[model samples]
Target: MMKKFGFTLAEVLITLGIVGVIAAMTIPTFVTNSQNKANAAKLASTISNIENAFGIMMVQEGANTLDETEFYQYLTNKDLEKAESTFGEYLKLQGNGTVTNFYGEDKPFKYIGYSAVPENITLSESIDVYQTKNGALLMFADGFNEITEDVAKKYGISVTKQYFLLRIDVNGKENPNIIGRDVFVFALCEDGALYPFGGKTSSVIQTGNPTSRHYKNSSGSYACIDGKFSAGCTARLIENNFVVDY
Candidate 1:
């Protein structure tokens, strides 16, 4: 009697079809969420590694502030090679070279479809690139504000500090080469602090106060908005405890 109560072939097929439809609808979203979490973790790890290395370097050099360290000296002198080499020494790097050398054949990074880019500079330019042992790419560039001032002014923002901008590609040469996703930016300040690009204000830096999570624009109609320049996304991510919600 129990066997006779079982569903007919058509009913079973219909049930299976509905299940398949549900799976199809949900699987991609699940996969995307998992990937986002993984990227966020990777980015947080890289940031921790960098801060630790900077701390260790300062301790080893008997320097209390980053500006006193030789690494900062190299950066101030615009000696990117020495800056990269010295900082690279502090961290565990697999290799260092031009962007093309490291990002070969990978799809060039986009701004998550947000048209505004840094200083209108090419994202895939031949910048100094370093790959960590964990496979994150660290790209260093100088004149953070001067280079990005035009775009900053467009949004009623200005970062008039002597800082170097660091671009981190959390997953080196990997897919989803999108800013605010796989790519983030940080500012190496003259005060020897590393800050998310849009974190500290000009007044805060001027006052010698410690940087805080006061990102001026991390939401809609401001910086880090989905369809806007994403330079502030780093600060946004940090504000969210490294969660990749946006």
Candidate 2:
């Protein structure tokens, strides 16, 4: 009979060492990739729901314009009762999900810049602060602001309705709420369309360019890019197919 011999102890130990080294090198990368993918999915889902809400509102309301008040009525009507306070009347929410409000001493959100750096931002209590059922925190505020003639042309669009901004934290109550990281910003135009930070006009539709008039990707910083919202990283995130740059 042919003699069969097991590998020596030294060979086994060497093989195990190599395996351990490979695992050590690749495990963190695998984890990071998995987490990033999860965050991206959450962001995409939130954006889709918001867009669908607006689309449905347009179909039902038979109108093309939306104020902050009207938009939430269609967007987050179901969770109206759960909020601490609202600026305008809410009629119905497109989905039957819960939205909890947080303001005052209980506020659980923070601000950040496009470079995924934290910032000092004192949020006015007048704004609405709420967390969606999908674990997204929405910092919403709406009002009309004047735009200079030069600014309008530079943004590649004519003046529109009262400006409404939405800053979203894809994973509510999670750490690293930095914009361009877990959080992103968006603008709901009076025309009833949702645009990313860098103006969704004919000239620039989600251009991640750092020099965009609406807002550009911050270099080693995260400052509110749009004249209205902070960080302006959403435009770049969208341009990058919803991938967050570390």
Candidate 3:
């Protein structure tokens, strides 16, 4: 007759310990990768929604260009209420179309390292916030500046007119609402295109190329600095095929 086939207590413990070690080594990495993928997807969808809303609004308003739309004028004039309301109408917002000031008392966004806040992002200025039906919060700021002659020469792009600035929270009011994480910044260019903030230019959007020249993927002002707020991280993420490697 065969003896007891099962391993002794020591052998069983050893095997279990090996399995535990393997799991411990891999679980956190797996979880992080999964979260990164989810964030990337959410960001992609948000971008598409915002762009589509603008396109639809332009069509309905009988406007051939974004400058012809009321939203553009409102933004130019820094009229938060009208700009936010127009966006709400175009996007078919679920709640009351209200544009709230998310400035002054407390800011909704946080740095990558909340406790050790960095100066990469400035929240002292006023910003207009609107929550979309999809749970993404759009923060609008009249932060655009004309691409100076020096900047044009450096990037080699002919873009002169600066457009709107958008700080978006892909997960709405969820935890870890930090820039370069759930929050991202973009430049809504006069060309009716959105480019990752800190990017060299909007040529990446205009050309439909992921690997474009002078486009800040993971470098320059928009680089994804560890434990710091980097608004241009959005462009870096997009250039890296939505992979949140950082």
Top of the candidates by lDDT: 1
State the lDDT of candidate 3 residue by residue for 205-246, as single tens digits.
323232342324444334466543466567678888888866
- Which has the higher TM-score value, candidate number 2 or candidate number 3? 3
* lDDT at residue 227 of model 1 (Cα atoms): 65
Cα deviation in Å at residue 229, candidate 1? Answer: 1.3
- Weakest 10 consecutive residues of candidate 2 by summed lDDT: 87-96
Question: TM-score for every candidate vs. truth?
Answer: 0.75, 0.63, 0.74
Ranking by lDDT: 1, 3, 2
Question: Which tens-of-lDDT digit does each residue in 1-246 have in candidate 1?
Answer: 354567889999999999999999999999978888898999888988898888889888899666688877885665666777888778988777767777674336676664545555564444567789899998877644432545445445444454666889988988777778888877765444566755655324423322332345444322666566565677778879988776
Q: Which lDDT values do the candidates have, in the order given?
A: 0.69, 0.55, 0.67
Predict model 2's lDDT versus the native.
0.55
Model 1, total clashes: 0
The digit string of per-residue lDDT tens for model 2 on 118-149 reads 24344545455555566677666654444454
In candidate 2 the C-alpha lDDT for residue 221 amounts to: 32
Residue 220, candidate 3: Cα error in Å is: 3.8
Q: Which regions in candidate 1 have their CA more than 4 angstroms from the true location?
A: 1-3, 63-68, 72-85, 105-107, 113-119, 124-126, 144-160, 202-222
Clash count list over all predictions: 0, 7, 0
